[model samples]
Target: MPRPPASHMPIADALRARIKASEWQVGDKLPSRAHLAAEYDVNPMTIQRAVERLIIEGLLEGRAGSGTYVRTPRERLRMVRSRHRERRGGSPFRADMAEQGRRGTWESHSQARVPAPDGIAVRLGIAPGDPTVRTDYEFLADGMPVQLSTSWEPMAITDGTPIVLPEMGPLAGMGVVERMRSIGVVIDTAVEVPRPGRATQEEANLLGISVGDLLTHIERTYYDTDGRSVETADITVPDVRWEIAYEIGIEQPEQD
Candidate 1:
């Protein structure tokens, strides 16, 4: 079997076995890398690799200014993407959090008159370099960062309107559907496409996870009654911490 790989695999397996045998309880700090290296008769780099593997597997977590510890398993939160939520009048994220007994809060910044890039332009069905209002958001649940999103709306739709700022003005934080409704846009549909990806360095830093961790990237767009794309957004969620759930409502046939 090609010499069974190398030293790190066996070292990682040994550590995993110890963890499985209750040798380290949740929140218990692991021994120093040097100590583990000496005990395993391997280089410190080898032990580091082993620990990193465990961390990626969610069995351990690294703390800054502290050491690695057995991680406390967390319940995966469900982020519901439902047509019903789209029809709701207020913040869908806040409602979702309320359903799970957690407070949902977000901080956002908006920049007006940003030129739309090709990708965003395609989603919004507008010409590239068209003016837009762009808003970036960091959403938290129970005061912990759980999601990130960036949304764009064409300036042609809401150039001088109160809802143009997204997170400011009178209709602040009411969500796309409600905000557009206030302007008589009447958003009729929303579409979302979810893709799995590796977390980038910035994403890792914000979510407090290792770089390259699993994440779900969702591209969502809302269309008005006339099928004009009114707003588009890219949403990011950590895979280890949340699961995306879609709630579909069945349409009833006409009753004679």
Candidate 2:
């Protein structure tokens, strides 16, 4: 009888090396939990834990009713925050993907006239009961899920306007700056704060990753010339999928 693999084989690391070695080619089913457990002389729960870690690492995929299989790693894309990339008319995401020779698109669902939550109210500088349009978005690059966002716009700024629905109407696909500009609101600046977070089950499902994956959470707000917040959003992207970059242009101080 073959020495049942190696009892000391670090389960997760051992499996990861096997997958990397092409022992299990992409789409090839991994060993069953029972099989792995028996071979390692460990509990099935131990095998499950190992598989879950690989899944979170995006090395393996789990299909309902089917066994786990190796997954191909995609190129890590750069999401740029720069003056030109932040322009209106075109979606920054779409433009970034195009620059990288990939196609990008997004789906958004909006609920109109919802009362602002306390936090949202503060962000938009509106009363708690103020009407707002809430939009949820999932962005895809080359047909792969890449980012998710939830945004709120106070109806006080967009009520009865052609651009109220965000993803609907004539200015539908335009960026917030352009949409607000069409209504005579000059969007002079935007702000964003990025933080680290762990992917929740719901976010994992939506982004096609595993729970506990690393995610970058961004709080983004658009302000007009008068410093009034026009729109605010919370955006999340899988850290493994994209690299975040910021570009700032420095101005010359007058030499005179």
User: Which is the leading candidate under lDDT?
Assistant: 1
How many backbone clashes are present in model 1? 0
Question: For candidate 2, which ten residues in a row score worst on lDDT?
Answer: 1-10
Error of 2 at 73 (Å): 2.5
TM-score of 2: 0.81
Please provide, for model 2 over 1-256, each residue's C-alpha lDDT reduced to its tens digit, 9 standing for 90 to 100. Answer: 4433333338999999988888998889998998988887877777888888888788888999998989888567678878777663567778888888989899999999999999999999999989999999999888889899999999988999899999999988777888888999998888999999999999989997779998999999999989999999999999988889989889999998
Candidate 1 on 40-135: residue-level lDDT in tens? 777788898899888876889988999999998766777888988766678999988888899989999999999999999999999999999999
TM-score of each: 0.86, 0.81
Model 1 TM-score, 2 decimals: 0.86
Q: Show the lowest summed lDDT stretch of 10 residues, model 1.
A: 1-10
For candidate 1, give the lDDT of residue 171.
Answer: 88
CA-lDDT, candidates in order: 0.90, 0.88
Model 2: clashing residue pairs?
A: none
